[model samples]
Target: MKNIETTLRNVGTVSLVGAGPGDPELLTIKAVKAIAAATVLLVDDLVSPAIVALAPPGARVIHVGKRGGCKSTPQAFIEKLMVMAAREGETVVRLKGGDPFIFGRGGEEVEHLRAQGITVQVINGITAGLAGITSLGAPLTHREHAHGVLFITGHVRPGDSDTDWRAIAATARDARLTLVIYMGVRGSAHIQEELLTGLPASTPVAVIQHVSLPDQRHALTSLGQLHSTIERDQLTSPCVIVVGDVVRGVAAARAPEALRRIA
Candidate 1:
C-alpha cells in the first residue's frame, strides 16, 4: 500500500475509493491506502462488510447506504455528513461499490464537496462490466466480432436524462456493438422490451448474477426470452446484463448445468 498522507486543511479532504465487485483484491492500491489512513469512512450498501473491516482501527465507519427496495440515506444527508466530518478536520473516505464514477453517484458527492471548498480524490475500481465480462470469459471488444462496446445502466430513464440507455442501445444495436447493462436485474423485462425496438429479437443476451463471487450464476438467452429466463432462473441483484453476439460464445463454452443453481 502506498503511504497516504492526507494533508488536512481548514476544510479537510475526502477520498472516494471504489470497492470493486465484491472482491477486495480488485481494489486499487490507492483505495487501500485511503482506507488505512481514513479518520472517517462512509460506505454504501453495495460495498461488502469485509472490505469495511480492512479500514484502520478506531476509524469511524458510517453506513450511509442506499439500495433498491430499502430505506436508504438521502444523498443530501450523505454529503452533509462528509462536509461535517471534513469541517472537523477529519480525513474522510467515501467508499462505494464498484467504480465510484461509474453510476455510483460519486460525481454528485464530489461536486457537493467542491462547492464547500473541500478537496476530493477519486480512485477508480474494477467496474461490474469488466468483472462480469471476465467472469463469463467474454470480452467487450473483439476485432473480428465487435468493433466497439457500450456500457449503460438499466436504472436510467430514457431520453434527456444525464444518461440514456434507450438511445445508446439503439445506436449500439444498429452498429452490432456489444452492450453491458448494470443494475438491470429487476428491470430485465422492461429493458428487453425497450431494446427490441432497436435490435433483433434473436440478439444474444447474458444475465450474470453475483459475478466474481461464490455461487455466481448466468443465463444465456435471446433478447426476446432474456427476461423470462432471468425470472425462471430466479436471478437477483448484483447482476450484469450483456447483449451482443459475444453472448453466443459464452453459451457455447458455459455448460447448461452450471446455470441451474436456483429456480
Candidate 2:
C-alpha cells in the first residue's frame, strides 16, 4: 500500500469514476484504487453489482441513481451525502455508469462538492457507444465507410418535443456517419419513424442490452423492423441502440464469432 500521505493529502477528496457499461475488467486502475480506498461509495442507477463488489467490505455504499419518470433520490440529498462524508475526513468515491459527465449529472455532483471545498478527481472509462459497438464488432468511424460519428440521447423531458430530427436523419442519409443513441428504448419507435423521413427504412440497426455483461444480448435488424424486434426480444433498460449501414457489417462479423464462442 502507498503511504497515507499520498491518499490522505486531500482531506475531503472525492473521486468520480466511470464504471463503463457493465464489465468489471473495463475499470481503470485509478478507479479500482478509489473503490478500494473509499470510506463511502455513492453509486448511480446504471452501475452494476460486479463493479460495486470491489469496494472494501466495510465501506458504506449508497444508491442515488435516478431514472426517467420514476421516484428518484433527490439530487440535493446525494450532494449532501458526499459533502457530509468528506467533512468526516472520509475518502469518498462516486461511481457512475459510462463517462461521468456524459448524461450522468456528474458535473452537478462535482459542482456541489467543490462548493463544499472538497477536492474532486475524475477517471474516464469506455462509454456505452464504444463498448456497445465494439462488442458487436462495429467501428463507429471507418476510413472507407464513415468519416464521422454522432452520439445522441433519446431520453428527454415531457413537453420538450422540440428536436432536430431532420438534421440527424440527413446526416445518416447523406454522409458517411453513424448515429449512436443512449437511453433510447422509450423513444425508439418515434425516432425510427422520424429517421424514415430523411433516411431509408432499409438501414441497419443494432440494439445491445446489458452490454459487456454475461447476459448481454445484441439484436441486428433493419430500421423498419427494429421496433418490433425489440418488443419481441424483450430488451430492457441500460441498452444502447446504433443505427447505420455500418451496423450490418458489425452483425456480419460478430455473429459467427459469437456463435463459435457459444459452441
Candidate 3:
C-alpha cells in the first residue's frame, strides 16, 4: 500500500533560467538544455523568440510580460503559476531575461518557490550592464579609471522613495566606482541634476538600448547632458545608463563594424 501511494505521487523540478540579453546565441549550455526539456515554460516579456524555439514543439509556452513602466503580469500570479505547474509534475522552466539575480526579481521567485516546497535551480547569464558596456568597447572596471561597479535600477514604484542619486554620485566619485543603472531613462532629468552635486557636469555618461540585439543603439555624452542626449536620440527604457570616468574614452574600443557611435 505504501509503495502504491509513493508511486501515485509524482514530483517535478523548477529551473529559474536567465535567457541573457536578447541574443539567442548568448544562452548558456545549461540554460539551453533546461529550456529544451521544459514541459512548461513561463517566459518573461523580453526573452527572444529565437531562444524560445529551442523548446520542443509540444512544450507549453506562457508569456508573463514584466517590462518596467508597462502593464505586467502580477508577480504573485506568476509565482502561483509556477507552484501549480511544478506540482503537476511538469518540468517547469521560469525563463527570465539577463542574469536572474540582477534586479530580475529572481530572489523573490526563489524564496516563494522554496516556501511552496518546489525544488528549484538557477542558471546565470550575462547581465545587460556587463553586455551593454562591453558592446561600447568599454569595461566596467578599469584599473586606472574605476575600481568597482554598482548595478542599480532607476524605477521607483509609487509610494517608494526616490533614490539618493546625490549620495550615489558622491560615492561613485570618491570610490572610483562605475554606475550602471537599469530602467533609468524616465528619471534621467532628476538623476542628472542630483548626480551633478557630486560628479562633475562634464563627467562621461552613455546610454545603451537593446544591448546585444541587431538594432542596438547608444548615445555617449556627459553627466550634465544625460537628459539632453536621451531626448535628442530618443533613447527609451529597457536600457542601461553608465556613468563615471570608465566611459571617458570608448570611441576606440573594438565593436562590430556596422554599429554607429553617437554623442
Candidate 4:
C-alpha cells in the first residue's frame, strides 16, 4: 500500500476517492473533504448527483462517465485529463462509485498518475456488494451458514480470460462461502449454468438492484432459477447477485410488513 500522507505534501496532488454505492450518506468524511477541496472533479456515471453537489463552488466538475456495455468516456482520455489538471496545480479528485481499488480501475489510474510523478492519495468507500447484501438483510458471513464470502465479477465472457466459474463453484460448495457477484445481471444466464455444474440447483440466490437508494429493489430465488428470476422480475444492470446458503438468512429476515406489502 502506498503511503498517502507522504504524497499529500506534493503540489498538484490527485485523490482517488470512492463515492460509495449510490448514497450520499455512505460517503466517508475523508472522501467528503477531498471532494470539497478538489479544484477539478472527475465523476463516474453511477455516482449520485447529491454527492457531486458537495463539490466546492467554481470547481470544474467533468462527467467522465464509464458504464459497462454503454458509450463511455475513453479511459486514456480521462487519465490524460486528470494528469493535465494536476500538472496545472489543480487538486484533482477522481470520484468513482464503490471502492476504486475493487474493479473500479483505481490501480490503473494510480499507476498512470505516479508514472507522471503526480502525487496520489486513495480514500476507501463502501462497495456496492457490501451495501447491497446488508440492505437486503443478509449477513455476508454467517458462521452457521457461510464461513467466508467471495467477491467476483460476473462480466466474464467465453472468449475472455479463463475465470473457471465451475472451479469457484466447487470451492464455494466445499468452503461454505457466499458469492457476491458484481455486474452479474447481463451475464446471469451463463453464470448460472457454470455454477450449477458444481453447486446444487437449490442454492439460495439474491439479486439486488440500486441498493441503498430510495427506489432500490431486489428478488430472492434459487441458483437454478437465477436467470429466470431476473428475467421475470425485469431486473437490469447495476445489480449485485449473491449466491449461497446465506441468502436464506436474508429471505427469512424479511419484515412481515414488507412481505405483506410486496404480496
What lDDT does each candidate get?
A: 0.82, 0.82, 0.89, 0.89
Clashing pairs in 3: none
Writing each residue's lDDT as its tens digit, candidate 4 over 1-263 gives 35565454445989999999989999999999999999999999999999999999999999999987889999999999999998777999999999999989999999999999898999999999999989877789998999999999887644889578999999999999999999888888999999999999888888999978888999888888899999999999899998888777676787655333222
Best prediction by lDDT = 4
Q: What is the lDDT of residue 125 in candidate 3?
A: 86
Query: What is the number of backbone collisions in each predicted candidate, taken in the order shown?
Result: 0, 0, 0, 0
C-alpha RMSD (angstroms) for model 2: 5.3
Compose the digit string of candidate 2's lDDT tens values, residues 122-208.
888779888988987878888776778888888876688646777899976788688888888877788888888887777778899
Off by over 4 Å in 4: 1-10, 157-159, 255-263
Instruction: Tell me how far the alpha carbon of residue 235 in candidate 1 is from the true structure, in angstroms, after superposition.
Output: 1.0
Ranking by TM-score: 3, 4, 2, 1
Sorted by lDDT, highest first, which candidate order results?
Answer: 4, 3, 2, 1
- Per-prediction TM-score to the true structure, in the order listed: 0.88, 0.88, 0.93, 0.91
